[model samples]
Target chain A: MSRAYNFCAGPATLPEPVLQQAREEMLDWRGTGMSVMEMSHRGDEFVEIAETAEKDLRKLAGISDDYAVLFMQGGASSQFATIPLNLLGDKTSADYVNTGIWSKKAIAEAGRYAQVNVVASSEAEGFTSIPDQESWDASADAAYLHYTPNETIGGLEFDFVPETGSVPLVADMSSTLLSRPLDVSRFGLIYAGAQKNIGPSGLVVVIIHRDLLGKARKITPTMMNYQVFADNDSMFNTPATYSWYLAGLVFKWLKGQGGVEVMGEINRRKASKLYGFIDQNDFYANPISPRFRSWMNVPFTLADDALNNAFLEGANERGLLNLKGHRSVGGMRASIYNAMPEAGVDALIDYMTVFAKERG
Target chain B: MSRAYNFCAGPATLPEPVLQQAREEMLDWRGTGMSVMEMSHRGDEFVEIAETAEKDLRKLAGISDDYAVLFMQGGASSQFATIPLNLLGDKTSADYVNTGIWSKKAIAEAGRYAQVNVVASSEAEGFTSIPDQESWDASADAAYLHYTPNETIGGLEFDFVPETGSVPLVADMSSTLLSRPLDVSRFGLIYAGAQKNIGPSGLVVVIIHRDLLGKARKITPTMMNYQVFADNDSMFNTPATYSWYLAGLVFKWLKGQGGVEVMGEINRRKASKLYGFIDQNDFYANPISPRFRSWMNVPFTLADDALNNAFLEGANERGLLNLKGHRSVGGMRASIYNAMPEAGVDALIDYMTVFAKERG
Candidate 1:
């Protein structure tokens, strides 16, 4: 049987080459005589893998020395709590942009640690648009400005990075970190769960400005302290070693695919074709506004809701899998991250057209 | 090349069959046309895997419905902070028995959240022995009594379960979870890092008595709340999906090896031979007291400290690998987890005898 085009929002699609490499190295990593999963994270062999992964990620994103790329455990959801704990030093409040599902979750978690001042919200309109920055009532007294660049569940994304003048701009890029080239200088810290554009779940990649360290609240757990992790090089405890190694393999694969700039072009093309068909057809429509529709996650609904099940069944039969949207908002979402190939998108488009014609 | 024995603490060793099965299923899991890594956690197939894994684990440990088995991220170290945050509800303090590195860490983390009562400490003895429970000064008003049943780094294992009276007993069983049969009803909560005896790193298994739920502090992060995890069936957020799947496979493998009791006998035999050789020989030594020494982790020192590097080199040459002890307390450690075959232990013993003779 041929491989399916996996459309999971996360634990999503990975490059075939990456999967193949992992398979070949499952028993022995580069003749080290042990599975990479079995090697100690502190061992020289894995250390080299770790260092090289960080180096490659730095090169791919053009990250500077001021940013510490720490490989950590717990997904981006954990970071929602950690960010506020680490950044809400003397300030009693933090500014948040309520864009969609992820931003709302982050805002809710932040409320536990600090006073949340929601500067902007798209909730009034079913989160179909990103509120313009000029209208946002962001706070100067806030410790940091937090937002989600791409909301995976609602399939809404901001086209431009928010400018936060003097305050630190912290963004959760879990859904869109390496789908394209991102400028590291514009943000104080950036974090992403690795399951999407990266390797697998369990490992989170954090890129933070070195100066942001050492301001955690007294009640913060050591594992949640950014300064502690930076001091120990993310080895404050045993990390997700297998996931880290697989991420290294993914970094190498990304580099081999002509880097993120190339990946950006490929991702753009894949998302373009899928979204294009959705927009062009009368039977299919993406709910989110054009400006806020995500390039990574394309969620669309059929003109007739009754055909939803039939559409999904046909899609599954055609090997287009995990196309269901988040249950919070019903429809279908195709998350075509960096790992998704153009052919996968083409296949989806062809299937959509055929299915529409047959049911029209 | 033949597979070498991996003796480093963890991400230590895994069953070869598990690795082989993962490799074979790497690309297309069960004709699903996508690797298990690529499947959405909520998808029917991955959901089945998670359910089966949870059921298998419960059966292997003889865990009753009264306990919730949670598959969490952030290894056992994170639990050092989470346990106190979740369990220390109304009580201002918790009881701790400091045996070695892991216990001290747990105790220290608890202090950040609650007042700590050090009931008994073996630190004065260089962590070479477990203090007798009769000398303990436990607090009746404490939230819970936490201890390290098996200290991986110090090679100490409790010979008897400490009776906590009405107080709950929590343990960091990272290194010793499935190496033998455990009576789940004997403890209130037990958590283990998956890299050892389980499948891989990044996943922590927690078995908590059901009554312990719903009492998290107001300040606790949602992800840190045991009630949140238990209520959500350990899917509060995107879990470590791959590790969860692999852990399910490891559970199946353990069952095939005749469950925990059979593995317990094999483990006892393996530890007996290695400790037997070290105990009978004058050329080597195990520093920890005999009764308290771990049956899973055996730490031994050469007669001459100068030959530590030489012994490791010889062992590596003979495909006996990762035999070096932890740098925190350097010498040699052979971690014979469920995955380490009896032959691997025999090989290590033969290499040790040959090396000692050569250096003698």
Candidate 2:
């Protein structure tokens, strides 16, 4: 098999050119005679790599100097705790809009530290649709408003950023970041796990408004404290250097492909092609509300439950790999991230067409 | 330059064969048609990779079933807080031995969660020697006794593991683990950042006795809880997948070199050759107590500090790299971990001899 379409949600597929460049430099990064993994975090070479990555990301995301972008470890799940630890200054509560599984996880973890106010929830609707912002029962004393911009498991996404006004807005953008242009100023903080659209597992990129710093609770582990990371340029300890370097390569590739604006256009087309097919076919159906459907993850179900395995098996046979849905959510999900070329989606749609005709 | 000897403490040099194998598999791992970086953490391929690495490490380190080996992130610095959070169940204070920078750091971080009792310290002695275990003021009510087996910056090492009777003994073996064979039964938990003798920088290998799990404080982040990781098989969150895979490759390479016993012999010889040259040469001197000299990191100084830059430049021209000492302790240091070949150490000795002859 020659680089089958990997749609594993995350640890998702990376660009082929990025992988090729990484391979070429694995033994000797340029003429350094050492792999980037072997470079010191404090050394000039790695510092340059780390800086270039942050700069490229800022340029791509349109992040301003008012925000400090941190290259951190332990993924977005770690940030679920980190955000509340660093943001809940003297407030007794924080508002959360529960859209799906990822949102609930954040709410549960934040509950350990502060009073969690569920302003709105789509769980009552089986997480297939986003609750209208007008229906929110927000807290006046809340420190921040938190929401999941894209839920990877349930294929649900928020169509609008909540208007938090004075309260800071925080978003878990793990599956959607770098897939399109984003308004960095709309949120007080935006964190995304690198595996999906960024680079690899274990690295999370955090863009935080500088004013949010210096508010960490006393019990917060220094490693999880945003200010400590901000002060050290995210090199307070030995960071995941290799992963950081790879992310820089990804940013370079994204630039070469004309930035996130271009990626946004391509991704919307890919998602539309697959979702369009799902709606037109009687044998397949997607449960997400059309308005709240994710452009990165498309979850669909077969008309007959028994044919699901056959659908997946046949898809794999055609080199469309990892089309299996998340274990928590039953049917099938196709995650078309930034690296998923339009060709991969075309192949998947072709396979789906053949399978539906044979099994319908 | 073609793969010069990297002597910075860590993210240190990895075995050439391990890097080569990783390079070959960077794009498509073992016919999976996806890089290991792109694999789902819960997928069969990555699960197999994760399990095999743990098994091989257990075999090499002689870890038993009573110990749950965890592949963790955030390096050893995170563990400085994690150890106290998990181990100080009902106890107020934990015993600590501060021999060098790393031990002091552990003590400082542990201070946040527990009443840290400095049982013994070599700080007054300039961290040149380890205080005898008999001199330690062991606390009867202490939760655990912690020590650094090797300090990368200070170039100090403990020749003997301290006896704390029934108190669980924890060792930060970040710079020394797997450089030699060890008695796993002597430790309650042994954690090492993987940049040194292991494969990469982002991953940390932890060998913790099962009895030590489930004691985390109420305020502990779920990501920091050892039991959560143990129960979830370290997939409680997405781990550093690529680093874990690279570590597995290094473990396989170590096995081919006849395991830790062979590595131990080679490491000893490498340390001896370098130290012997420094001692014999008048223009160079190593300040460590003879018995306490690190087998992994050798920090030395020139008789005239003025000649330091010239010495490093000459060595770099000969394809020897990263030999500069830590800024906190200015001089020259060569880190010879398990991956640093005996020939590299020999090359360093030859360069040191010539530098002495030229500048004496």
Candidate 3:
């Protein structure tokens, strides 16, 4: 079947091999005579699937014994509320470093649960760059310091992990997870919605320090309590089994592609190629600072806004789909996630160059 | 491929045709060159799928303009908390009729939000029958009266809708929805988790009276508020798109089979056939009162407990699976939902009769 290079921000493009395997197994998964969707989450078959997915994710993220991996729903947005609900115990305040749209959303949701202190914000500069770490004024007794490593909307990312001293540091790594290697021990928690880099949309992978469990407020639902999920092994309730299964397949695919380390180099190469083309061409511009430009989502605009429709329409006709930018910041966003091969990015760059020459 | 007649109470057996269609469409859904899982929920293609699903569900349920149908996540368990969060506005007390395990859970969760009044309970009666409506002590000024139309574990179902007079009646129809036809106007609200009779485990269907949309507690999450989902047309956040798509197919299949009215008749016949066989055999027994026995989940046991393992082993050898009852109430349960055809139930009865004769 002919396929397109889909650049959707989320519910995004997935590995072709994973989709093929899922199709092959859809009717009778591994000879179980039932679809994965029909298997009881409590059944041994599904339990094994869930356990292996968690194990694979731990391996991929290089998670250690001190961290508990949780598979949850409601995406990264839900974690905006859950992070504070689970961590902000007696402390009435927490520090948040806002890089772009996702971090701001996290701060907004955290405000409902705790006193949100904006330790540093790039919004003053139109979210095109991350503020220097020295500029942050983190509270001494704050519950935790939170930030987003990669903002999907503005295509800005942080190159270094912030040091929070003895306090826990949490990062919403939704868009950049598995794109490169990182020291998992550096942060107290890392949560990622699985649409872009992992597998599917419904599952959110959260790696939290063991010490952060069991401090939820009295009003917290059992489903949202970190301890409840950790104790139950992320089976506090019936999970999104199909998504979990697909995530496992993606994990296996990642392992086959020489794991995250090799994939990181490929990702960097692909990002540099696309970014180089944009920077070299006067007809195209990417406003994000060079040091903080995201490796996954690259938001760029034509020098002439009138050509936006032409670019998208021409790209669609050529089978590059979902290139429209977020309504909050519009132009175009080419999300080159892990599943997106270097060939796909090269194809996109070729199209962008051709469009620029024709319209310039 | 050989398959088993899985009798799991939930995450239960799905129709073979549904599975077949899903398999065929897994790689390229309707010639879109991508699986439904790979599509963006906000895309026009997915929007069409979501709208068609909602429209078909409304047709199957015979829902009217007075009510709004919502496709939500977190299952019925989530709704246990969401109901009180949404309905307990300005009211301190809500009446609960505790019929079985599910109602008890709903009551426990609701207690976190408001004062719960147990109007009637069948725990004293071993949860074998629904308490007579006259025995209820419903509060005159309560926000709503909540009940479970079917108790899956205990296998008791309300044969008649309770009259709430001026007060609104709410029903958790997770196990009984689509098994029968009912007057949509009878209840103020109804919610069903999709695993049993719909498509998958992750999606939950909620139908609420139009007037019940906006009165939520201050602490209610925007995701849990019915009015928010209503306003966004259940796209307030990324929904479980593939599950929603399969549910739409299930609705179409139901329509082709004469919709829920005919499905109700088929369900009753299937239940009676199995129940009749069990009642006639001395070795087999169903403890539920005949008048209140659920058509969806039928719980039963052998005259001797020692034969339980042997019965299950023999059944499995003959392609019967997941017949083990819930751990809370041990024995066996056959959840013959709308997906379980008459032939499967007939095969089950034949196997039971053969096993019973040999055991005796």
The top-ranked prediction according to DockQ is: 2
Best by TM-score: 2
- Tens-digit lDDT track for model 3 on B73-143? 88888898889989987889999999999999999999998899999999998999888888889899999
Candidate structures ordered by DockQ, highest first:
2, 1, 3
State iRMS for model 1.
0.8
Model 1: per-residue Cα lDDT at residue A67: 86
TM-score of each: 0.99, 0.99, 0.98
Q: Which stretches of candidate 2 lie over 4 Å from their true place?
A: none
Error of 1 at A101 (Å): 0.9
For residues A68-88, could you state the per-residue lDDT of candidate 3 as single tens digits? 998887778778888888898
Pairs that collide, model 2? none
State candidate 1's DockQ.
0.83
How does each model score on lDDT?
A: 0.90, 0.92, 0.88
> lDDT (0-100) at residue A307 of candidate 1?
90
Residues B21-123, candidate 2: write the lDDT tens digits: 9999989999989999999899999999999999999898899999999988999999998999999999899999998888888988999889999999999
**Which segments of model 3 are wrong by more than 4 Å?**
none
Candidate 1's C-alpha runs over 4 A off are none
Q: Name the best candidate (by lDDT).
A: 2
1 versus 3: better TM-score goes to: 1
| DockQ of model 3, rounded to 2 decimals | 0.62
Docking quality category of candidate 1 according to DockQ thresholds:
high
